[model samples]
Target chain A: MEKLRLGALEAGGTKMVCAIGDENGTIYEQVSIPTTTPKETIPKMIAYFRDKGIDALGIACFGPIELDRDSEKYGYITTTPKLAWRDCDIVGQMQEALHCPVGFDTDVNGSVLGEVTFGQAQGKKCVMYLTIGTGVGGGIYSNGELHHGMLHPETGHVLITKRTADTYAGRCPYHKNCLEGLAAGPAIEERWGRKAVDLADCPEVWELEADYIAQALTGYVMTVSPEMIILGGGVMHQEQLFPLIRKKLKEYINGYIVTDELADMEHYVVPASLHDDQGIMGCLELARRALENDH
Target chain B: MEKLRLGALEAGGTKMVCAIGDENGTIYEQVSIPTTTPKETIPKMIAYFRDKGIDALGIACFGPIELDRDSEKYGYITTTPKLAWRDCDIVGQMQEALHCPVGFDTDVNGSVLGEVTFGQAQGKKCVMYLTIGTGVGGGIYSNGELHHGMLHPETGHVLITKRTADTYAGRCPYHKNCLEGLAAGPAIEERWGRKAVDLADCPEVWELEADYIAQALTGYVMTVSPEMIILGGGVMHQEQLFPLIRKKLKEYINGYIVTDELADMEHYVVPASLHDDQGIMGCLELARRALENDH
Candidate 1:
């Protein structure tokens, strides 16, 4: 019997990572397409997978993407800040071209699903994965599935109190000091006048960054209370931010709810083990699940 | 078959509401017991239901209550601020005395479950029920089930930016300016020189209170994205606070994600139609589910 082949697309703002893989998420073929417009990018993805004869396709899309499987606009990417991609029906186009089952979800949800299925949060009943990139977003995997509701969880937009020492108005046009507005890569750049990659060694930058991240994580801890929180994305590469975030999480939690996991923060809050591959791997997992649900 | 009788106990810091009801949550008999020591209160509850011959029991407890059924201490209420009730195994005691299957959960969760089952949130797939009493807390009922994870949601502790005009340190022992600390009844009294009940007529007092609540609800909206939000508890009784919170919720959202639900704010955020009986009725629902799940 032949192993099941799956097409995975990790679509982002800057680039689209396209891959053809097996059920195990091992990439047999891969391609990277720089994001220009829907016309240029979606075709590249469709062309790559069209002849691959993959059983199904999974798309981890930069959203707010529609996920209601029954809606007429279910697969459409609606209301994105990226003007060119607004209301783009990436799923519909792909399905129309390739004629296969397509799984669609936010990039963060896919990332978390990847982590849960094959990475850090494997076998955990409750888990959270956060990406602190140009913006902060998270995916909640609870009870062995990605948690989705009215819209997908907009964890990035959750409002967080501004730090006493920091006075920069947040970069988010919506909520001025929300977690993303305060702690995301763009917000950090705006506040420190340097990109997060350049300011990796600056203690003061990480201290405040960690402060905001810690506060946001504390909110997640209190609200979602996931057993494990996996942190990833561009800014998290700064190794110095981890301990600071862990320490502040402890102080902010204040032992109101005592747990051995809280005491040993290292075991609970962790960096994503899959790193860059999480997107494609998660997409593969999404594809597999979509196929399974079809049966 | 005979109608199944279930006993429900809505235990709070102030009082205990014990009731016997049917599977439809119709109360046949009810009793109110003033909250005191475990020795005083638990027995009163035991005696009330001991002879009632209930097939199953449910406890809607003011927590943090242990919900993990497999743990040795699964039914214990751990780490409550109420000194007399700390670490009380309310579920175990009642189960031992009454010899019936017992369902247990936080009071807010019970209320939301009740609301979803038979009250205002009926037919709503995603809903949130919030109690803004001495301490603000909430329950998320998403996709027709009570949302639970590593632990129940500690929504009260979600951090919110304090209103610039309000200078009072929050009342929560942990995270001084958390939603509860900034917006709870105690916080209201401490911020202004009067309790929420007394300050009902003060437009300025409710304005700040509404500001903080709106910010918190905005966070919940961005994170949970519930279809309908049912606001209960003592502070919410101030009828003027509703429109102010709805208006601020709209402003905080900033039209980033457009929903018709957001346009009609008055219908989205509503008072708890069940008012105070949500707890015992929710417990009744819990008991009925427990009995059903047993098979």
Candidate 2:
């Protein structure tokens, strides 16, 4: 079968990217729309691919969204800080307008699917895609599928051992010592009084950041045992973090897992190859998968 | 087409229990044999099952054992402290003698499969069987299968935050402050200068144990999001750890997951219902699956 034209939506807290793509990951056109109210946002997204002739639509939306298909509230973003879009049925509305099968998942899940399908994690079986931006989140893809149990992985909220001599007190609302609170982009800015981009040359900043990320990765690797771990999001833009995280992760693991891949961190820990496009491309993959499922 | 008689082996470090059972988890007969040299141990297990007329065999062995079906050392137990059994191809040896299909997995995986098949986690889609015993370990049953990626989940070795004011330098060789190091049976005995059974009267002991267990569960819950978490092993036998772990897990999670189930600790975190039979029962399930696959 030939590749079908698919619609992809990358829904962030601040903005939404709507694109017309295909199973081949070809983005025909993409338009960014400001996320105001659902009333404002829905119409703009509908307007983008109104007659794009899509076979399916995939929404890689910022969560906690209802991804459970059995639930009536599936595709509804719930309890988000974005009050205007809370409980909004983004997938339902898109499916209603576009009359196409829609695949709905968290942004991080989409990023992982993107990596496995077209980015850094291509050809890998079990993989972890961790994005350390304003928040820390992870997506796990294993055996040709995104893992969703009671809920998709809420990796950002898991607790971590605090780095000594570094007491930022953390900023995550739920857990004070959570990975997101301790090591995310906001945490970095909150601790250093400067954003991650601005602190690119600071050795202490990257080392502390690397230590925390490595700590989180330590838990992730031991529990999930993903073959490859792909780091993305805004904070990972610092090239220095890769090497630092690699060394620290090895030290944290301490030869617990005897494998050649763990020894060679250069290949094991890598930057996202798709970068900013991971979410949207992942949305495209979701759309493609949804279309395939429909058939 | 009827249920086939299966041979089940629960190969622990100190001893091995071999049983004959069926798909319905019925054990026709069982025998316990002391674990000595592989040469002695192999023949004893074979002698016990030789005239059993089994259709398939399953072994739930201790680690670190090679489980990857694609690896050349797939059935060989590797890098184990049990010097006599190290590099022993238990599965291969059994299959050669029995002339039947064989299923191999870690003891924890077998335990979770046991729980999912016949114990507390029965009828659940995603479940975690965690054993806090001589050593800490967990087996994940998701979508009706034991979770095995690059390797099985090494939940015990994952780093966790130290409980306040309780400073017992952890004993896990891999990581300093790991789940096993903080909460396992040996760790508890080491910290309190008495076994968990003897320390039952001491409020401080179980409180600290519960705190560490709850902390580990927080990471597991946030990451795996299993519908049910069944507690097993000797440390979990204390009985007092149950309510404390349930309450502490809720506190650790702290409304991060909004669900009625999270509120009801009575049902969420539970003791293993199959008790000592979980591993042998799980091996029957493994054998059943293996027999089914043979067709």
Candidate 3:
């Protein structure tokens, strides 16, 4: 089979990364555009790939993006924090402009797919990916497919135990102290009055941050029982948070359920290996799958 | 295809419920045997099923049972608090004695499968079944198959926030404040100085108990995003606990992820429609699957 040119887009809250890749996920051309509004951003993304001769486009977008194929708004970005993109039919617009098949999913889901296809989670049956950036979100690859049900796995919105000493009230608009509210990048900045990167030396900051993340990870471990949990995004860049999270996970789970993966904590929970390219590569994989299915 | 006779067993901590059924999960005859030492109990179960012309046997036993087929201890009950049956090779023994294909999983998983196949969750793609009996065990049917990884989901041990006024350390031997520790029948008994049945009228007791359950269910809903959650077991029999749980679920989730199921409340979270027969009938379905797979 001839290798087909593919288009990949990693649409974030701040910017959109548009790339021309191939069936093998190798990028041939890529560009970034500021996410001013759907009207402006979607057109720029489509124009970048218009002459790329791609057979299909795959989007790993900041969501809640509608992925339900049966819905009329299936390819539209639904109620997201990025107010400008809400209700924007990014996939439909791209398909109309490029006249090619398109695939769409949450950015976190794309990351997990990227890891499963090309990074640390390769060959793993049950894999989980979590991004703790401006917000907390997770993607699950379970039973050899990206898991989706009524919605998606809303790991960030799940409640977590609040630390008794800290009373900062969380930053999330919805659940005040949910995993996202307490542990996301903005949550840390708001709680401690500084960005996570600047607070690396403060044990108090990372300790509480790690505590919240570990608490949420414990929930993931117990419920999803993923073979590996990959943590990424801005906050996880703090190297010390990993050990604290590993320790807290052990403390929380308390050996009630045992597995070699849990015992070897180092392998069970680790930072994402794909780095920033996960979303783009994952989008390429999704595009590959779409084309393969079409065939 | 000729219908095959199937044998189903629900091995509980106190007693073993044994039944002879068919592929359709219809019981031809059923009996109960007290759970004793494996030497005595295994022989009695074997004696009952012998010469029954069963094509397959499914054992939905009290666990933590090893379910990984590649492991040396695949069918053995491992490290269960039920000391008499710990490390017992229930499925291997059954297969050896009956000379037929054997299916084995946690009793909770069996119940979920039963519900999916023959009860309330029929035709549903994503479903969760939780048993809050002597212990708080759960099973998930996600993406249209029973979910299992590492070990099957030990959801009972996931941590929950302790209520402010409740000081009792909880009854679980491991993880003192876990979901099972706080909301299991024994947990309620230990916390309130009475069994769940005896404390039926205690609003405070039921309210706190319902709060912990709802918290755990919130985690389940967030992670699994199941179409339905079925609550079963002795603790759920309080009946009043259901409304309290539904109310608390709405509180914890707080509309972060919108779904029609969450809005309805009553339809999304429900009691097991199969009631007491869920585990046995689930075992029968497992037996049926085992026979079907053999073909």
Top-lDDT structure, candidate number: 2
Candidate 1 local lDDT, residue A28: 86
Note the residue pairs that clash in candidate 2.
Answer: none
lDDT string, candidate 2, B1-295, tens digits: 6878999999999899999999888888899999989998899999989998999998999998888888899999998878888899888999999999899899999999988887778778788888888898888888767888788888988788896598799888778899988788888888888767988899989888888889888998888888888888888878998999999998888888876557678999998887589999999999988888888
Order the candidate numbers by lDDT, best to worst: 2, 3, 1
For every candidate, give the share of true A-B contacts it also has: 0.71, 0.73, 0.77
Quality class of the docking in candidate 1, CAPRI style: medium
How far out, in Å, is residue B191 in model 3? Answer: 1.7
- Score residue A191 of candidate 1 by CA lDDT: 89
Per-model TM-score, in order, reads 0.96, 0.98, 0.96
Give chain B TM-scores in order. 0.96, 0.97, 0.97
lDDT of each: 0.85, 0.88, 0.87
Candidate 3 wrong stretches, greater than 4 Å: none
lDDT of 3 by residue, A63-107 (tens): 887777778889898888678777999888888898988888889
- Model 3 chain B: ten consecutive residues of lowest lDDT: B169-178
- Candidate 2 TM-score, C-alpha based: 0.98
TM-score of 3: 0.96
